[model samples]
Target: MEIKIDDLTGKEIIELIGEHLQGMSLNSPPESIHALDLDNLKKTEITFWSVWEEGQLAGCGALKELNKKHGELKSMRTSSNHLRKGVARKLLHHIIEEAKQRGYLTISLETGSMEAFMPARKLYESFEFRYCKPFADYQEDPNSVFMEKELSHFYME
Candidate 1:
């Protein structure tokens, strides 16, 4: 899979993000949805990426600079056709590497707490992310589960 910085203007990616938002709406209440829309994702602090395989969009994710030492993960979604194909994994690894390169000491994320999000939670867990209290501007919410991973600059994977 080839991962590259995305400008959020492509038809395929727009549709994929739309599908992601639609899925979130199906599983979570409106107030509990923290996923950003295209406009928000385009903000200066957010770096968005899209994964393509054989010229087809496979997945996408973003890293948001919260501060000099901190970053946040956002909009991680694998296309339905690319599920279980390691798309999300590859994209996640890329994001983490980028965060480390940017001198971020820790990366945090917020995901759904529902049963439908079990797979997502597991994926983060596999990467050594630990469940934690809300971080950044996030607040404690029953519908949201927060996780964080400390990035050791000297640690080689």
Candidate 2:
């Protein structure tokens, strides 16, 4: 799969983001949905990427810079046709690597606490992210599960 920086202007990505938001609405209450819309994803603080396989969009994800030392993962969604095919994993690995390259000391995320989010939670867990209290602009909410990972920077002599 080829992952490229996305400008959020393509029809395929727009449709995928729409599906992501719609899925979030189905699994969580309106007040608990934290997925960003097209405009928000285009913010200067966020870097968005889309994964393509054989010229078809496979998945997408984004990373938002919380500050110089911190980052947040957002809008990680595998396309309906690419579910369980390691798209999310690849996107996640890419995001974490980018975060490290950006000099971020930590990366965090907020996902739903519902059953539909189990796979996502497990994915984060596999990447060594631990549950944590709300971070950044987030507040405590029963419908939200927050997780964070510390990036270990290796210094070369």
* Top-scoring candidate (lDDT): 2
lDDT of each: 0.96, 0.98
**TM-score between model 1 and native:** 0.97
Candidate RMSDs in Å, in order, are: 1.9, 0.5
lDDT of 1 by residue, 11-49 (tens): 999999999999999999999999999999999999999
lDDT of 2 by residue, 77-144 (tens): 99999998899999999999999999999999999999999999999999999999999999999999
lDDT (Cα, 0-100) at 106 in candidate 1: 97
After superposing candidate 1 on the true structure, give the runs of residues whose Cα lies further than 4 Å from its correct spot: 155-157
